[model samples]
Target: MPQTPHIAFIGAGNMAQAIIKGMLAAGYPPNKICASGRTQAKLDQLTADTGIHTSIDNLSLCDQADVIVLGVKPHMMGDLVKSIAPAIDPSKHLIVSVAAGILAGSIDSWLGQTTPIVRCMPNTPSLVGKGAAGLFATTGVSSAQKHTASTIMQSVGLALWVETEAHIDAVTAVSGSGPAYYFLMMEAMIAGAEELGLSNDVAQQLVLQTAVGAAQMAQESQQTPAQLRLAVTSPKGTTEQAIDTFNKGDFSQLCSQAMAAAHHRSKELANLYKA
Candidate 1:
């Protein structure tokens, strides 16, 4: 049997901790995982909580890991990659970056080698083990390395690969920023329910449960979301009335416009970071 790859996370922030915890919950060996961060206290706490190794030396962590997961902020990625570049063996180490808006090319350049790289755009939902992530791999990435990257992301939630690196921006628009859009809708629904004479507590409870139920139904049913909507919308029904209002308001078009804005912004941020 193949030995488990040793993975090292370059940062010990919330997202890193979430992934670490998720992997632990999924029965990944704690001894195989390690994390490095700026604060000793935080790293110590993480070690205490997960029984994984922790360090303050990034280069040493990279030396010990077969897969180096960059979990730092985008602005810090360049310096972090460069600092550990000398320690990395492109033939032996696979790079997986979770820093948003940092392109794979930029990471490759920073590493100063033709390293296998997987760029992942994972959302805040990963904190709760319900994230939807989009991954893109560079040309140098092997099939096995891609599987390793996917498995790590999957430990948290849904993980899908995009055809091209540019499609990562689309993923950013849809899933990376997707959670905020849903939260906005929930806020509107809760306010609307309260306006309709429901108490604040009741309105919030009902709106949240409704959102959860709808998502669960969509996941479990084979039917497309559009088909499910049609199934629920009877002629002259209350659902039809609400659907008509949304249509009249051009809700679908508005959603498209909003997502486009997000896509454009994602590109802008990437360019800014690359510059």
Candidate 2:
């Protein structure tokens, strides 16, 4: 196995901390993982929790890191990259950004023309070590660098690469914003159950377990989702009635529209940080 690179996170917020914890759990050495934050309090918390090095000096962290993860906010990314550009070694350092709406071109401009940049969109589920992330790499990145970046993201969950940066927006709409969509659906299901006389606790348990089991089955089954759905639907059964009501409400179209809106917003946000 290839030796794991030293991973440094520029932001020590929840997402950064989640990845750091995941890396440690995945057997990356504690000494090889470090994070920098703007606040002493957050840095202290990270150190106390992970036993990894933490600091308020971003530039210093970059100097020692083999793979640097930019976990800062979209608005702050430009300035942060610029500030640490001097410490970045294009030949040795790999840059991975988890900030939304920040494109690889803009990041390369802020850092260096030859900087190996990988743009990633990882969702909130990463906190629980079950995230789904989409990555897009710039021309400057080598295959080794790509693998390193993938390993870091996979430490928390699934990491997939997109052929073009444009597809990252579609990913942002799907897995990036997907958890909230499921949460909303579960909320409605639980509320409907309560209205239909199920106790609150019972409804919550049923809906939560159903979601878990459904996802597990979908993953384990050889059949596609459509095939699985057809298998579940019997002739004029109770499931069929619920499906009919959803179809009448144009559920599929509604979901498509929602994802399209998210894709559009992602583009708009990226434009805001154009170089």
Candidate 3:
């Protein structure tokens, strides 16, 4: 890997902490990172914890970092971008955003066209170093800048690029919010296990390991998920009985409907910014 350059985070929240931790763990020294937030106390805490420089002003962070990451909430993005626009210089800096529902074009428009911006959708699991992010960049973005952003994002987990903006919404619906859906399923499954007289510890460990192992197996296999399901279901086994119920319940249809709703809402959020 190339030497990790100085990067500044415009927010010192959980998501930013996750990125900072992952980068630090990957051998990026504390001096290469800077964190800025509304509160001095929060910035102070982050500085103490990570040894990175801390600031309350976005402009100050912008002046010092090679990459300036917008880490604030979606709705605050427009104003934040405008505020930091004066500090960005195309020759020396790259801007990357982690605000969901905010587009790269919008950031460029707010910052003046010379600055390159990248919009990314990353999830909460990044806090624990298990994150998946969807990234999209405009033509103005140089290859080196995209790779720099990718380096920061991939520190947590996987990243994929999409040609158009719409794919980021689909990513928000899937990997970004998908973890919550899995957690919900795990909760119910564990409850069902405990009801069958398994101890809480055993139930939790079994379900947790099952989810991890299943994900690993899926990644390593050439088979489709449907094919994997069939491989697990025997002629007269317990798995077959569960599959019969899931099929009867139209699991695929339900999943499609739920994901569609999430995608629609992401678009609505972007429109809200326009409004």
Candidate 4:
């Protein structure tokens, strides 16, 4: 087997930690992984838990890593990239940014080098190894580097590449903010069930299970979600009545509008963080 590349995470936050845990679970060597963060205690905890190297010295981490994951906040990305720029060898190092709204070009500019950069939009579910992420790579990235980036993200969940960077915003609208959308629906369902006389605990449990089952069915079945919904909705039945009520309230349109709003906001954030 090929040796795993040295991967370094620049920020040891929840997302970074999730990716690290996922990689470890997937059998990536602990000795090949390292992380750095602002808080010594957190880095100490990560080191203790994962057996990966941890430190507050970001530059040293970059020097030793073949793939550098920029896990800092968007506002901190510029300075962080600049600080480690001197340590990066563009020919050998691949930069993977999980920071939202930070563009690949901006990172390159900050580094003052023609770097191979992969910008990834990974969701919170990544923490649980069920994430969906959209990745966009700059022209400088080699095919091999792209594969490496995809493999790293896939350790946590589903990873797909977008044809253009703009589509990443659409991805953000879909998967990045999508978990909250589902959570909101779950909340509404639980409330409705309680109003219909189900106890809170029962309602919560049933709603969560229903969500899990629905998602699993959608994943495993050959039928599309629409087809599955129609299959479950018999003529003049309870499911049909519920579907009718949702349609009456223009649920589909509302969902579209909400996603569009999220997409627009994603662009706004990108612009806000641009150098």
RMSD of each: 1.2, 1.4, 1.9, 1.2
Clash pairs for candidate 4: none
Which regions of candidate 2 are displaced past 4 Å? none
Q: Over the full model, what C-alpha lDDT does candidate 4 score relative to the true structure? A: 0.94
| Candidate 4 displacement at residue 112 in angstroms | 1.3
Tens digits of lDDT, candidate 4, 1-275: 12478999999999999999999999989999999998998889898899999999988888889999999999999998889989989888999999889988888889998899999999999999999999999998888888889989999999999999999999999999999999999999999999999999999999999999999999999999999999999999999999999999999999999999999999999999887
Whole-structure CA lDDT of model 2? 0.92
Which parts of model 1 have CA positions greater than 4 angstroms off? none
**TM-score of candidate 4 versus the correct structure, residues matched by position:** 0.98
Better of 2 and 3 by TM-score: 2
Candidate number achieving the greatest TM-score relative to the actual structure: 4
lDDT of 1 by residue, 1-275 (tens): 02588999999999999999999999999999999999999999999999999999999889889999999999898888889989999889999999889998898889787889999999999999999999999988888898889889999999999999999999999999999999999999999999999999999999999999999999999999999999999999999999999999999999999999999999998998892
Model 3 / residue 232 / CA error / Å: 1.4
lDDT of 3 by residue, 189-266 (tens): 999999999999999999999999999888999998778988999999999999889889998899999999999999
Question: Per-residue lDDT for 59 in model 3?
Answer: 91
Estimate TM-scores for all models.
0.97, 0.97, 0.94, 0.98
lDDT string for model 2 (82-103, tens) is 9998998988888999999998
Cα lDDT computed for each candidate against the true fold? 0.93, 0.92, 0.87, 0.94
- Lowest-scoring 10 consecutive residues by lDDT in candidate 2? 1-10
